[model samples]
Target chain A: MKVLVTVKEVAEVDDEFQISGLDVDDGSLEYDLNEWDDYAVEEAVQLSEADDDVEVVTVTIGPERAEETIRMALAKGADRAVRVWDDNLADAGFLDVDTKAALLAAVAEAEAPDIVFSGVQAGDDANGATGVALAERLGFEWAAVVNDFELDRDADVASVRRELEGGVEELTDVELPAVFTIQTGINEPRYASLRGIRQAQRKELEVRTIDDVGLDESVLESPVDRTDMYEPASEGDATYWEGSPEETAGELAAFLRDEGVVSS
Target chain B: MSVLAVAEHRRGEVRDVSYELVTAGRRLADGLGGELNLLVVGGDVDGFAEDLNRDGVDTVYTVDDGEEFNHGIHAAAIERLHADLEPTALVAPNSVDGLDYAPAVAQRLDVPLVTDVIDFEVDGGGIEVTREQYGGKVETTYQVDADQYAVTVRPAEWPQAEDRGDAAVEPIDVDVGGESGTTVNGFEEVGGGDVDITEADVLVSIGRGIEEAENLPLVEELADTLGATLSSSRPIVDNEWLPKNRQVGQSGKVVTPDVYIAIGISGAVQHVAGMKGADTIVAINTDPNAPIYDIADYGIVDDLFDVVPALIEEFGGDPPEV
Candidate 1:
């Protein structure tokens, strides 16, 4: 069995930053492996470790800078990596959900993995749609926000617990050849070991363009255009407690007391 | 041209977002000078359709299907409905269940999809959606340059339409029981542990700002000093530094404590959803522009390491050394 984990290198903005135009300034943006994908990678790796002949491959749609982030996944446990990037994708103003799914669908078709895992959502775009959309494109079954699951190889079913809103977990069984969007808290993602890091340097990190992935530049054509970006106007009517930490603490203490929730 | 919004439900009751979707769909339909249609599938469709007949709703389409939400069934039903109606806009919730099927519907329909939309406008030829990115640090507007598109509205962004209207209730029986690849066994209630954060009057919620598990004692002492319960944002629970029961977020518990003190938390939209109803909110963080301050009644823009300890001292409790 093979598991393909889709990972993304998401951009996290600095505490104080500048929006140059349609995006935050490059100096203000820091890229890291998406938080949710870390869990997905761990889930795939754990599956590979427990079972024989389970090859874990990582796939990402990012530029060259993201290879560093992809390596983090490889250093943990993925057997190899595939990265799809081209000049067209970088120039593409905004990639909407459809465009992303189409690009990923092309790769999944070629790989033909038994199972696909994607983060529930990226920390940056937070569309939370790519995985299921890709499943739709591939004609595969899917489950979203999956926090726990047990795969039955003989029956070709996965008994999963999907974390719903407000403390509810929906228990579901999805057939094989499926996509499961891994949610946070599903498992503890391990830190890359020193030995694994050295091995990752020698692993196959194949880079592909749109053409290489059997996709044309037309795949980059998106109907969505990012028009404007700005800091949201502060809705805070919060009274600032200005002073040293001690003085602000005193003000908070007094306020808590005044509210009668706390007593001095 | 009309606008269609899918009503969401779980277990036996309709979700609040279903009504909010009506309110959102009404706005889009009004902008396009068209009709507003609501779609309810599975689990008390008739009752859901009746409750969804808001003041501005023009029609309610019910598909009597399974007892609970099945994404495969939903995707098939919605795809057929979209084809038959050809609505200008397909609006659904950005909730967990919505994510399960909305993307599939959009993909099958080959229409552009924008999720977690906070605000939108239909003008001239296209729709413009406003959504937050980079963890609510900034808002970006996207122009969907298409006549037909799909969007999932963020919960609680729009007020629910309460005034009842006599919308035409049409039951559309689409064949959706062909082959569902997934089966929902049942639902289990998680996060039931020792302390129920929902019952607390005061909550001192620590987030990623607590730094490490060892530093948790610092905030625990603060919660102890003020006779408050200790709760946390999702990261604390994800890290296993705190129990799942102590998590305050959309997935965990909706806490309406008298006072919610957010420490070192940037206040993601999900986290804010759980505690925004607090009578008084206080935020302590180093970042002056954290989203938590936007909703807080009082704020201290300082390092939590310094302010938390001082606050503990102000309450006449010795701060624990991390």
Candidate 2:
């Protein structure tokens, strides 16, 4: 089995993002493989390890700097990497949801992986739509917010355990060539090794562009627009009730009732 | 100029978020000095449309197709509507389905797509949207630069509109061509047996401060007494003490209940980002300076072990057996 993992370079999750002073186009902030995507890549690596014939390929879209993110995946044990470079991609305002779906569709067309994996959502947008869209585009089965997975190639089915509203829901006998969008609690991602990092420098990386995938730039439409960016005003000082556990609970319940948040 | 709000439903029943989207659309339409039109699409959605029309919609377009939701069908339907109605803006809830389809519609229309909008207003000539960034640490406002804009309104951010006596219902025939490339072979519900936290008016969210899985029952007891639901921060879910659906954070479900009770949660920005919209927030933690208190309406600086049991007892709820 072969797996294709989609990764994106996003603003470092730990960075203090400033809306007023920063340029939206200029890549001024630190970048890393989306935190959730790392888990997807790790899942792919685990699959490959579980099956010797399994191959894991990592793919990402960004400028040349995005290669670093792909390299991080390689260092984490993906067999190879692909970097779809377009320096103006982000500035083109082409990062909307459908463009991403189309881009992944194009990648799926070229790679033909048996299984596709991605984090439920990206750190930048945190919309959690790509995997579902990609699955829809590829006409493959899909499950979202999955924490556990077991694939049976012979049966052409994948059993997934996903987090739903109340308890864990088990999806058994799902068809294969499916897409799974992993949730944050799926697994703890492993750190890259120094040896792996050194070897990643020599790993083969297949680079492609929008044209390479037969997608014309004209087909890309961005329905959303940004008029201006400004910082949100600070909320007023929060009220605090300090007391013994019993007293505090009593006061808190009373306050909730007073605020109409709870019925008396 | 008119605004079009997309209505989402399952099994011919409208989701609560649809009402919220309509309410948001009415506000934006009013701001733009236009009328609010609602677009309902689904299989056997006529009854759903009739139910939706009670909200006093100026125009209600119903597309009753027997097919379940597909991105291609939804996109094509939206595109067809855009061509005919020429709405100034299109709005939907920032839900899983909306995120999947809205971007496709935006890409098809060549317009800007603003998502996770907490607030929106029409300014001089464009739409201004406010959204949270950096996992809720910063709130950023954007002014859209497109003639036709698409936005996904965050749930709970806007109040549902009051139902009007009646509304004009129009049957809209949309040519949703054959499946674009995807088909819903089947639909399986996520975790079974758990209540939807989004629908819960009161949520008792536990954090690492709970210490052990056994202590969760104490929180559950309080929730039961208050007729509330039990939820958790990411760490509790990560530790497998609670299901992921109950996880409240950027990576989990975003809930804005009437009342939110946080026990032993240190309150990371990611977690706070998801729940800051709640009407009233109460935090109980040993640390007086926990970040959860920064946004909490009431703070209890005490050990949860002492607090939760007392809460259960005071509320006439059975305390968990130690």
Candidate 3:
């Protein structure tokens, strides 16, 4: 089974972030591999380690700077990396998620992997649309927000559990060749071993342009318009209770009871 | 012209957010000078379909095929429904199931899809939706350039639509089968078997200030006395003091209870992202400078050790069930 994992690099903003036009201020922002995609790469590497025949491949769609992120995935054990970039996409600065999914699906079609794994959503957009949409565009079965996953390689079926609202879970058997969007805590992502990092420097990392992926310029057009972005309205107008801990607790209970949250 | 609201139901009951979607749908439909129509997809869901027939919707379309939410069936059913109705807008919950299928339906129809919409409006014969960005730190409003769209509304943003007698239910039969070819086996419960805090009206949540694993029962006593569920921040769950299911944060679960009593939680952005929707927030922290104070309606700048016991006593001296 050939396993393909999709990874993205996102900004890590610890301090206040400023919106500069259609994007955030990248001055203090440090771009690293997305937290969720790290888990996807780790899952693929672990699956490949279990069986020597399972070849692990990593793919991404970003600027040339993202190749460093691809290397990070390879250092954790992916056999190879593929990056998709185009002047049309970079010139637009931001591409609609649909176009990105279309381009990624095209890449997936070219690879034709038996199983694909993508982070449920990227931190930058947090739209959570790309993976499932790519699956649809590629005609692959999909499961989203998966937590506990088990694969029966012989049956080409995966018996997995998905995280749902109110802590409810759904267990399903997905027939491969399928796409699975991974949730956090599904696995503890492994770090790059010293030896693996050395091998990653020598690993195959290929780049493909939009023309190479068989997608046209029409799909690359920006569809959504960002009219404005600003800090969320400040909400700190709170009344601090100043009294003994006992008195404060009693008052708090009374307040909540009045709010009809606690029955008195 | 009409806006289609997709009602979500599970375990034979329609969710509260489904009604909220109707309320949101009504606003958009009114703006578009159209009516609101509801669509429910599931098997043995005649009751849920009837229950979804509220006053706001012009018609309730029920597609009885899958027992639970199957992504393929939802996409195919919505596609077929859109083909016939051609509603100007489609509204659904920005939920796990909705996120999985809404974009697919949007893709099939070749329309722009937007998720996690906190506010929306029909402006000058076009659509404008506002959603959070960078983990709710920023809210961006966009002008969606599309004649029709699939929008997933964030929960707890609007009040639930009041039921003013049931509307006429128009159950429609359509093939749930689609070319995507995915199957539903079954759903089982995972994580620690605890009361789902997401469903609770009141939640007593703790954080690193709870200090140690041994003192968890103190919070439990407060929760039990108030008839609230016991929940915690990621630190407590990371320390294994509580199960992952009860952890409230971006990585954990999103919950919007009526009252969230945050004890000893500093209110990190990630944690706040999950529970920011609570109607009233009462935070107990030793530091008045805690970030939790920003969003909190009330705050007690005192030690939780003293306050929790008094709160538990205020609810009367009933021993904690735990």
Candidate 4:
């Protein structure tokens, strides 16, 4: 079965950003593949390496520079890469999850892979919506925040364990050709080897646009728009301790005991 | 116009975030000069919704489908109800379950979607949603058209709504095609070395204090005494004193434990970023000026070697023989 993995490139925003536009400040701003997407690429590549018939493909939606991220995935083991950059999308200024999902869905329709993988969320947008929305658009079964899963090739099914709040986890069985969002720490992402890196530069990288993908111009419109941004509110006023070690320990224990955090 | 909030529940009990949603939703609806309607789904949701109206909600819409947080059911049902009502805004939690289907519902309606919202405001003609990225290092606010939108609310933002007398309850059945796509086989609770720090309830996390790998047993003993999982800050993990999984920092795991005891940790910004969500923070440090104390609920200005023994003694927990 063919596995398609979705990746994203995000700006490593420094503390200083352009205040007038809430954009990254002009400096040594580094652009890298999203932190969470590393796990997705690793999972897909691991699946491909373990099976003889499985092939892994990586896709992203960004400017021309995003091909570096695709190459990063290829170095990890993705067979090929696809990048979608439409002039309309570029002109939209900002993008909401739906617009990104639309572009991703177009790529998925073009690839028509048997399964898809995406990072649980992006470090920049942190929307956590694209994978699920893309799945909905593709009419594929889906699971979110998955830490572990086993694809039953014979049964045409997958059993996935999802990470939930408060440390709870649930395992479910999903039919194949499904979308699974890979959570961070799900796997140890392998660093790109020298040989792998050299080979990735020679791999297939497909470039497409909205018109090329048969997507409508309306797909460029973001339902959610960013109007303004600023710093978050500061922390609450904290009471500091000025006592000796024993006194502070005693006081802290008492406080915690009263708070019911430490019953003893 | 009305604001629709998805009342999230697990098993048969309503998650506290549901009430928080109602509280936030009530304010949003009032700002728009509209009503607040909550959607409750599941098989025995009638019981969960019975007291849901005690708060700021104007109406609680119940769908007793007998399923517990099914992604397919909620997505399909939400899409159906959204199309039927055409509410001004739809809100759910930015949780595993909430994010699973909220986007699909929004996409199905072709409404603007936002996720992981920390806070929001109703502006002149639309709503401005604020969400933190880069681990709260940067905050971005988005403006969505007021006429239609769907978004997920982050947990623990607004206080749980208090009783506001009895509001009306409305039962609505929706026809969402069977399962959206998958079926649950079962769940496996963490019991062993899977030791996902993110899943621990109480974490006895150490840092540079233990000093040497030989001193680990001290913290391990204390962890056993408190029945807490053992973890540490990035320094220990970087030094290979602890595994990466045991590290609690930005590059490590983001944990929201009920109680986090930082032993000898200085609380760097990146380190504090991962533990900021903890319900209660206890920092034990020799330096009173440590940054951890700023966010810690309780601070003990003491050396870990001196204070940990006292703590173990106070709890009457026997430390393993050194």
Whose DockQ is greatest here?
A: 1
TM-score of chain A of each: 0.98, 0.83, 0.88, 0.87
Task: For model 1, name the residue pairs that clash.
Answer: none
Mark the 10 consecutive residues where model 2 chain A has the least summed lDDT.
A164-173
Top candidate when judged by lDDT against the true structure: 1
lDDT of 3 at A263: 78
Model 2: runs farther than 4 Å from truth? Answer: A12-20, A23-32, A50-53, A62-69, A84-115, A129-180, A186-202, A205-231, A241-264, B67-73, B179-204, B208-231, B243-280, B284-295, B299-322
lDDT of 4 at B44: 74
For candidate 2, lDDT tens digit of each residue in A166-238?
A: 2324343457788888866677678999998999899999887777877867535554444455444435356
Interface RMSD for candidate 1 relative to the native interface: 0.8
lDDT of 1 by residue, B40-96 (tens): 899899988888888999999999989999987788788888899999899989999
Clashing pairs in 4: B43-B66
Per-residue C-alpha lDDT of model 1 across residues A1-264, encoded as one tens digit per residue = 999999999999999999998999999999999999999999999999999899999999999999999999999999999999988988885788888888888889999999999999999989999999999999999999999979998898999999999999999999989999999999999999999999999999998899999989989888898999999999999999999999999999999888887866
Candidate 3 chain B: 10-residue stretch with minimal lDDT: B176-185
Task: Please give, as one word, the docking class of candidate 3.
Answer: acceptable
Local lDDT at B278 for model 4: 95
In candidate 2, the second chain superimposes onto the true chain B with a TM-score of 0.74
lDDT, model 4: 0.79
Q: For candidate 2, give the docking quality class from DockQ.
A: acceptable
- For residues B1-322, what per-residue lDDT tens digits would candidate 3 score against the true structure? 6899898988878988899988899999999999888889986667887677777878888888868898888887888889898998989888888887887788788888887898987887569889877656567888887778778898777889877745677777877654445666676554556457789889999998989888888888778778889999876875567887898976577889988989999886568868999988989998665668889999999998888887888878544432
Candidate 3: give the clashing pairs.
Answer: none
> What DockQ, on C-alphas, does every prediction get?
0.91, 0.27, 0.47, 0.40
Candidate 3 lDDT for residue B165:
47
Model 1 alpha-carbon drift over 4 Å, by segment: none
Q: Best to worst by TM-score, what's the order?
A: 1, 3, 4, 2
